[model samples]
Target chain A: MRAALAASVLLVAASAAGWWLTRPPPEPPKVAEDQTFEDMDRAEYEAWMQELGYTD
Target chain B: MLLWLAVLLGMRFGAEHWLPALAAAAEQLDAGESMPVPPKPTGLASLPAPGTPGDGQRATLLSPATCEAMVADLRDVCWQSLARQVAPADPDEALRVCARVAGSEMVLECHADVAESIAVADRARAETICAAIESRKWRGQCFFGSGLALAETDAEYAMGRCAHAEVYQTFCRHDVVGEIALVDLPAAHAQCAREEGDWLTRKTCWHGIGKYLARRDTSEAAAACDASTAEWRGTCYHGVGWGGAERDADATLADCSTRGPYADHCRHGVAAQFKRADPTRAVALCESIQKADTRARCLDFVTR
Candidate 1:
């Protein structure tokens, strides 16, 4: 009876070890949601246009 | 015995408990937190000493603080070199120094500042610098800078002339044109008209003259247009026709009559005018029309 109990415990521990060893690494932190690219105004647009020599 | 075997196998496979225990023992010995210390980064020992020849030359070699210091030193050196040699007694030497320094962004900015200072000290020196730079491959920059300097010094004609130069046209004609408009509209119009073969130049010239006319006398505007080429004349007549049509139909017709190839357009415009003024007069005008299209358009105008 004691031998059978020991075998069951051994199997459970073996499975846990296997699962832990094969687990994927933790993911990196997420970027902030507020970051964006759409942020220029009309004056900035005109300045760029002038720099590029567009008259109209 | 089975439980012992399982524990040994588990340790062989994967376990963090042993790591924490070892970390705790180490920290206890060292009297610190029970956390594993990270190893030093690779290549830290290979770096040269600060202020050494190769220490700050490359970006990757310096730490952030050291990099900032190196950049500051480089900027100071560049400024000193620019101030010293950018205004050499010999024009050619000054140009050579400026060109050499222009390779660096900081030095190029310094050179510009130094050039402005020289312009203020002696206008002749500024012109000489411009002439010297004109011979270099960077003639466009030379012309643009000189034109701006001259414009600032109240040399309107010279500024316009410089703007019309090939180098200035390539780099800054649009900007120069704006400055020219504020200083001398007639000169600007003349310059643009002279470049008539180029469609853009012709259009810009016509537009400039048109704006000038909007605020000036009609006779002056007419003279400006007359001085232009055939294409510009057409443009002027078209503009005047639009403006006149809005104010007076008869005046629009008269303005359209001044240009040919547009005679059909003029006839139609006049026919519409007459219809608006007097339908009977429009029908009478249509009677003597030669072209079938013109006559048909005139009849439609009068009937409508």
Candidate 2:
């Protein structure tokens, strides 16, 4: 009876350890959206032209 | 005891499953070691109520008084920038940049600064900036400011006309002809005559004489006409006839006949006036012109 109980305990411990190791790691934090400096440059250019008498 | 150990290990594994997630949540929430809190977006949040004093269709974040103060500040900056720059390599680009500064509400304090900068950089560029400002639809302030700036520079009469026409028209009619006294009227008249197709220039020329005529009697009006170029003389005679002298139809015909080229047209115009005033005198004067075609036309009118 002592031997059977010890074997049962070992089996349960092995199964739990296996489950923990095999499970996927939590996903990494999501990357924030990328932005470009060019958008600001273009906006500045448009604003400049509007000030100058080039209506188009 | 073995079963209890197995249960402890299972609980440990379950705890392990949630531990990383819990750690991440805590990290995200943590205000971590003396770092400043990010400022909230108060600009958007603190916007004034709709329809408030400074919040109509043309509402700006700055009040009018605030904008004026900013404009004054910009004027100083503009003067400083202008002093530093000798010339702009690209006048067109400079004009564009200056114009932009002039128009932006956020940067409006920079408008006068930009204008002064352009003036120091390139006078032509400054004019271009003013012209651009003048062309916009709702341009009361822009037009007046730019117009005054342009007047300081030497643009053509047309540009001056464009600049002054809007504002001057608002308060009082612009005596375009009267303004010509301050300019080279003959050259301006010729330029206008060339650029404006049809009879617009002729009309303007006639209108312009009202200023000179206002100071003169009929003889001086005639002498001024005589001293004028042939085209202008013709116009001057026409002006005289139109300016309350048409009652003496025969005299107008005699005066205008001396101008030649337009003589036939003038004769016909006088004849029409005479027919209105005294048909008999018009028939006699038409007969005296000795052109058979003219005489016949005159007789036809008298007969009619």
Candidate 3:
């Protein structure tokens, strides 16, 4: 009986430790705002084009 | 996890604290530097006369630095290209380069691009960088970049990143899912089906498949769209129209009729593309749509 009890205790502890080891991370608050390409500078546009590989 | 949470909190709350420091450092560096003209490419034959047949092909091989020296007008573009190359490895130095840029928008773009570059290896750091950006537009672009890089391996995670991208979030899907579509088209479609969002989000997800696929092969893209569920078929067709417009707007508009029931939606997409450049043509195309609601939306796109 003592052996079974100890195994149960060990199992519970392991499960708890597992949960602690792999948990979902806390995320930042969601904020919403909008802007358009018209507001983008030519340099910024060029940078985007380069990022997209549209130009060298 | 605790440290990660703290870092996120710091980014959310303390961006203002670091920005000035970065600016000051940038200023110090800028003041110490001299604006010397960029050097010309060595070991290159000169005298490529303008309009020469091979001249344009050779220009494509020139480095950004060489281009900057050759075209004095587009100096900022050259700097941006140089910074883009530096961002993935040394973001701080890239930011310093961006800081000296005359335009504030370009500065924000530099930050966004740097965030994207680092996201390939360290997404957590990239998100922190994105959250700290002041402009909503650039922040979205930064997240979009992160999502694009992440999509190569874990598309679901990339979609999660897309959620953080502010106004440009819709476009993030357009490119991120579009990237996936280029590889496994069916999987891309399945992802769009499982995606949880508003109608616009769902529409853009499907649109991405059509847009990116159509860029490679129009007929295949069309077949892929036809294979999709009826609910999003029109959306995909619209994407095809948009893709085609990049090359030839007139041909794209004319080809819409071949789409049958979805033709009006295709025309709607074409009209949207033309709204900025040729509003009259866009309105005329909108008028051609038989569907009253779609026509109204197309007209709205043209007028607005």
Please report the candidate that would top DockQ against the real structure. Answer: 1
- List TM-score (chain A only) for every prediction: 0.52, 0.47, 0.45
- lDDT of candidate 3 at residue B207, scale 0 to 100: 80
TM-score of each: 0.32, 0.26, 0.58
For all candidates, what are the clash counts?
0, 3, 0
lDDT of each residue in B142-179, candidate 2, tens digit only: 23333323332332532343333232211111133323
Better candidate by TM-score, 1 or 3: 3
List DockQ for all candidates. 0.04, 0.01, 0.03
For B205-303, candidate 1 gives per-residue lDDT tens digits of 453343234223334445555665675554443333332343555555565555455444344434444444455565775664566875775575456
RMSD of each: 29.2, 34.8, 22.9
Error of 2 at B88 (Å): 46
Top candidate when judged by lDDT against the true structure: 3
Docking class of 1: incorrect
Alpha carbon deviation, residue A38, candidate 3 (Å)? 22
Q: In candidate 1, what are the lDDT values of residues A1-56, reduced to their tens digit?
A: 99888879778877565434433222212212221112323333322322221211
- Global local distance difference test of model 3: 0.63
Candidate 1 lDDT at B8 equals: 58
